[model samples]
Target: MVKIVALVGTNSENSTNRQLLQYMKAHFANQAELELLEINHLPLFDKPADKKVPEVVRQMALTIESADGVVISTPEYDHAIPAALLNALNWLSYGIYPFVDKPVMIIGASYGTLGSSRAQAHLRQVLDAPELKARIMPSSEFLLSHSLQAFDENNELIDQDMVAQLEGLFEDFLVFMQITSQLGHAHSVNQKLAESVSWENR
Candidate 1:
């Protein structure tokens, strides 16, 4: 089975973003092994002088590095991704290159109508940074609007159309993973370049 790391992009206990990931985990259990990673416990990124990362953060990086792909479920805060998620990404990129050339799938949930469109766009830009270089799926997006009513008592998506959309995107992701795995001729170079990014020169 394909191994996927799903990042829960919020610190809130009642986050619908997390709920959306949970639903994906269960729904895709047969096709992929989805592990939900929480960004809530990561300490605020401080750009430490020693350049030593927390063991927990390192472990998180290791897990992400070994995954076939990543799924990030984000929520908009001030029309952008939450600070917690951004902080986690900061940690993941500092002196580490887990995201370099890694395949990524972006998803989002929101209570409002825009369905975190701005945040998803912002996330794509962030992931494309030289230090990250994640290969986000093209022409694909899964947005769950009015997320409070998107699920049911069984923790499954309530709307058939929404479920169908998710299923199609997920299938596309599986194919994308395979395609990206073969597009790794420059993977090592990308990782090295990402590691060599110098903040002191900036």
Candidate 2:
């Protein structure tokens, strides 16, 4: 089975983003082994001079590196990704290059109708930075709007149409991962480049 890390992009106690990822985990259990990673406990990124990443962040990076791919479900806060998720990404990219050449799928849930469109676009830009260099899936989006009512009492997506859309995107993600794996000729170069980036020096 393909190992995938589903990043819960918020630290909120009652986040619809978390619910969306949970639903994906259970819904796609047969197709992939999805592990949910939370950023709630990671301390705010401070860019220590020594560049030593926190133990928790290091472990999280290892998990992400070992996975076949990552799925990030974000929530929009002020038309942008939550600070918690950005903090987590900052730590993950400080000195480690886990995201370099890694396949990523972006999804989002929001209270408004825009469905975190701006946040997802911001996330894509962030992931494309030299330090991260994630191979995000293109031309594919899964946005759950009015997320509070998107699920049922059982925590499953209530709308059949939404479920269908999610299923299609997930299947595409699996294929995207396979294609990305084959495009790894520059993986070593990319990793080295990403690791060489030092924000403090710049």
What tens-digit string does per-residue lDDT give for candidate 2 at 1-202? Answer: 9999999999999999999999999999999999999999999889886778889999999999999999999999898899999999999899888999999999999998989999999999999999999999999989899999999999999989999999999999999999998999989999889978877886
Cα TM-score per model: 0.98, 0.98
- Candidate 1: the clashing residue pairs are none
Clashes of 2: 0
Residue pairs with clashing backbones, model 2: none
Clashes of 1: 0
Q: Among all windows of ten consecutive residues in candidate 1, which has the lowest summed lDDT? A: 193-202
| Position 141, candidate 1: lDDT | 83
Candidate 2 regions exceeding 4 Å error are none
What value does the lDDT take at residue 79 in candidate 2?
80
- Deviation (Å) of 183 in candidate 2: 0.9
Root-mean-square deviation (CA) per prediction: 0.8, 0.8
